[model samples]
Target: MTITTAPAGVSLRGVGRAFGDHVVLRDIDLDIAPGEVVALLGASGCGKSTLLRMVGGLDTATSGTVRVDGHDVTGIDPRCAVVFQEPRLLPWRTLAGNVALGLPRDLPRNQRDSESRQWLGEVELQGFADHRPRQVSGGMAQRTALARALARKPGVLLLDEPFAALDALTRLRMQDLVEDVQRRSGTTVILVTHDVDEALKLADRVVLLGGAPTGVSVVLDVPGDRPRDHHQPELAALRSELLAGLGVPRRTPLERETHAR
Candidate 1:
């Protein structure tokens, strides 16, 4: 059984961020539908994570407003949960103990165990609940983190490069895990990733952030379905567009020359 929450929609209006003399983002406005998956893609330091943090109430925008479920975010909003790049699990705690930490404080004591077990099972970690963080692989640790977040029954899940630390194969597995869990739970998700194929594989729409001007953003609606084939010919054009926006070449110099001719 999946632990589900009434997924919440996220809204950003005229959002901008700046340090004393430098601006990182400006005039950014976007809306994410409830239970939808959106990926924020760009080169490093493009404010993708910053924008996600704002939505989760982890950071404040210098201008404009951010709302979740139509309520303005003023603090660490309870409606959202985050799974960061690192698993960030406590070394001393057993996997179950760590996941239990995310359970609602008001939940009846009798239901906590079942709740914890259900979420751990969601991430395919039912067999490792008794193990400490020190005993598991990096991918296992990250799966624990994901379970913890989901146990919160968050309306929106914020993912900040959650698979960046895993090996390529492990990363792919985690992506599938996340996609499966999100589909089951029906929570809105905002993923901040630098990987173009990852973005294309999972997102309903991909938003590219940053440019020469910095913080200039573009949104592309990705066709096809979730858990899409990475090499789908339809997505090739979209990949080229995203790479161009990030100022990355999609082909070798010779390939580019050949195409030009």
Candidate 2:
């Protein structure tokens, strides 16, 4: 639980990504401090996940720079680890075995198993380490995925809508689990999400990407600390602003009544 690994900062300067002539992102610039949590929110097809992929070196930028911890990302970055929308676990591996696969290869086999079990405990999946992916609930499997990512002790952790498929209550619980784990591990996080409230509740800053070839349209600093109440007055106001930025303006009281009629 006490992580000595130092977190890494991120810098993107004039970053752009294009698939041949069809550009998805261009001239994007943003900086994320180490140990910070940033959530990317935008309309569908706004290149939110593309931007996240660039950070993790899962995709390359067509032009400009993508740097994590002051080094350019040329390929799959060793400094980064990603957890995707689905659990994507190996069906045959036990939960601990799946997590142990990410352990540093230099570690002795006994240490690897011990470390993997520790991470599972960190994610509150302590006793479920022996369960296979199909034997656990969706949220439990997702927690195992998180444990696997954390077991790598990555400097930057990339999450691409990792909680998107869950029911409301499970989603909230997962968010809380992520906040707790990030706080303890001091890992930098970049989260790609479609839910505005989820972004506001979890991130230190919510980066809103939009435009024809998606750029940083708005960078709203979320007030308060982690584990925030999304319904707070300021968050409500910021939520409305973020919604409008995504082209989904909130309905006025009069409009709501009219629509109900």
Candidate 3:
């Protein structure tokens, strides 16, 4: 199989979407450079997932263009894949089968399993390949889904809170795994999440969406080193900024004063 770098990142011009009368996203323009990791950060109902859906071609933009690798995604691309909050794997299929399902049908059986095994190894789950989804833990299932997406060698990987359901420890491990995989694969990634800390830790740029018909509010450049400490001072500050941008209220002066004494 051939792997091509995503063309000129992903460019969005006047991208907008709505469901009947509910306008989810307003005029938005953004550019994600090739091999860049961008996080779409916002509170519930702020349309972060809507934007991701549009970018993924799972949903159409009510207005404007959604382009990936310089090609308009009027429909899903075989080269771009998504992993949602749920593992969404077939219960009847083994982990290896699920991963190999993404491979082109023309590939010989050996080549397909070889690709799946390599991706599973990347996530440290090579031994679980023959297990069914129910036989694995939530974290393991999520890892399988991630591996399935990676096995295809997609130019873009759209993740909508892929680790949200995992335990805190597992979530951190998955975050580290994603960082490592993206570094090695150079896959352009767009992750959508409500967790400020998650966004700060995973993305090169964190974009905050705000207001009734949500639109881009603040775009923060996360320049901290990769595999960054989630407890780092700079990340803490960035998290605070992101929380504020989402209109999350801060403590009152009275509370501050009381604590100060």
Candidate 4:
């Protein structure tokens, strides 16, 4: 199967989204270069996912424009793929079948099957291709969901908290898997996640969304290499800063002393 080597760049120009009188996003301008991994961090209901949906062409912006690879996204772009929190796999289909759903309909059936298996293998699920979604563990189902997305060889991947439903350890493992796949495929990615540490671990830059009619409140460049150490002082410091930005309270030294008294 051929992979798309050139990832797509994304541009959001004065983007805004509203449902009737309720505004979700407002005048948000952002750019993501080809093959760059960016994480959108925010509390629930802050419109981070809405922003990602506009970029994916799954939802429209009420104002401004969203472009991928220089072309405006008026609808679902064939070059993009999206994975949501739930695996959303078909109960009746086998894992291979689910992954094959992402392939082009014009492709030969055999070729589509071949590509599906290849992607499953990429996500470390080669042996489970025949298993139904119900037969696999949650992590495995999510992996298959990821394989389904990657099989399309998308130029841009939009993930809406893909691992958010998993347990802590499983989520960490999924994060590593995604990072590895993104590194190998060079796909531009926009990940919307509420977890600060997850963003720091997976993203080259973390963009924070906050306030009413949410816009990017902070853009942080994560220092260091791939597979960042969560316990590293730099990451911890950055995590603390992000948590504070997300309204997670941190006791000051004086407060800590007072509490101890």
Which should have the higher lDDT, number 2 or number 4?
2
TM-score for model 2? 0.95
lDDT of each: 0.89, 0.91, 0.85, 0.90
Error of 3 at 26 (Å): 0.9
- Which one wins on lDDT? 2
Better of 3 and 4 by lDDT: 4
TM-score of each model, in listed order: 0.94, 0.95, 0.92, 0.94
Model 2 residue runs over 4 Å out of place are 251-261
95-142: candidate 2 lDDT, tens digit per residue? 999999778889998888889889899889999888999999999999
Residue range 217-259, candidate 3, lDDT tens digits: 9899997778777677556667767877877855444556799
Model 2 lDDT on a 0 to 1 scale:
0.91
Evaluate model 1: give its lDDT. Answer: 0.89
Look at candidate 3 and tell me the lDDT of residue 173: 89
Q: Mind giving the per-residue lDDT tens digits that candidate 1 earns over 1-261?
A: 657789999999998888776888888889999999999998888788888899989999999999999999998989999999999998888898888888989888778877887789988888988899999999999999999999889999999999998999999999999999888889999999999999999999999888643564689999998889878878888888898888886864446779999
In angstroms, the error of model 4 at 14 is 0.4
